[model samples]
Target: MSRLRTPTHPTYCRVVRASAWYDLVVTAGFATPWTYVLVHDVLSSGGLALGFEALPELDTWQVLFANLMGSVVVVWAVLRIVRPLPEHGLFDGIARTLFATWQAYALAHGASGLLWLFFGIEVAFGVLQLVPWRWGRNAGSVTNDASPTDGRSDASTYWK
Candidate 1:
């Protein structure tokens, strides 16, 4: 049957759009640190210092992992931008777990301030990720127009 439906509440659509934009901004913001660190490492032979003593070893791995995670997040964020939530659910969960690990590592390594900031941002994104787009087949607002029939919605399908 071909079904025609209208949103119960229009504000929910705005919320979904705003949430997606927030995710995009957060993803881009996360990438900034990686870029800054990379440039610092390249420009300064002494390497980037986090207001502490020489941490060449720690810095190397941390920067590498941060860059890799940032790249992954950017891709996920693009998927979210195109498809909205609940589409990349599993990938979002994995990203959140990895972000938690990264936060813990930063805390243990004496970057608690930075860790707390990242933790806060990640928490917000994680909460958004858990939002249900389809609830009990009632058709939640966010996923209503999202279908594999469109190319944009297919971004996260590959991960599933």
Candidate 2:
């Protein structure tokens, strides 16, 4: 098996926590209609000021989708913040990769240049999160599906 150097435990944990905090702050606004209204305005204004395409006028479907995404991401971020585990980072990285892919697709279809800012962050965090798993080491040599306190070998304990 090819082994790549991975970040130490502390570094990996810090990165995970940082990503969680970022998600909590950024996505919190989209979690509700009241907040999404303000967030939309801010993003639109910012995009225009930066000479990028502003977000289109709000639609019920768009708001609903954004709310759903925001709610799920906020909950996920909270979990990571509460417990910065190696597994959390690995999974979160995978999620970020998926999100980045969709974001890129939207951009290609002329969604908005402002999305580039979020895309960059997602890619950076995703790469950092997956690097440890890509190597033989699972975030400071932490074994996947292994519990330190119990001797169970079930995969259900991965998130615990």
Candidate 3:
């Protein structure tokens, strides 16, 4: 049996919001030096306990990069959580694709296997946000033949 698909707007918004929540929870620790220290230790310990290679010790530059990434991601995640718009999902999906690509590169270069966990999540959320969603027949009482004619660029409605 074919599964029924829901409307694009609410489902896409929820997915975007959910990704933001996940980002907030995960990256919030990396936003500060003290918290990043604790996060690094915990991740290292967890890796060893799980029989995976522990994360490498970070130098000052590495720590700075981590904190900077965390700070930027945390702020972006907040914006998505607050607005949860379709445009946000598109941009976030693009960002996730970049993140997943770099993650794959790091994994190939012998970064900790623990990174695979995050890589998987990045791929999942990226795909979820990037996939096109069809409008449901009952959604906003929109008929299947209905199309938007607003002045927005074609790129915005391309997926629709």
**Per-residue lDDT tens digits of candidate 1, residues 50-100?**
433333443656666656656666776666556543435535645766777
Which wins on lDDT, candidate 1 or candidate 2? 2
Score candidate 3 by TM-score against the native: 0.79
* Backbone collisions counted per model: 0, 0, 0
In lDDT terms, which candidate is top? 2
Q: Give candidate 2 regions above 4 Å deviation.
A: 1-8, 135-160
Top TM-score hit: 2
RMSD of candidates 1 onward, in order: 8.4, 5.0, 7.2
User: What TM-score, computed on C-alpha atoms, does each candidate reach?
Assistant: 0.48, 0.82, 0.79
User: Between candidates 2 and 3, which one is better according to lDDT?
Assistant: 2
Q: Per-residue error at 16 for model 3, in Å?
A: 0.3
> For residues 1-160, could you state the per-residue lDDT of candidate 3 as single tens digits?
2322323455677888899999999999999888999999999999999999888887898789989999999999999887776667878888999999999999899998999999999999989987754444443433322225452323333244
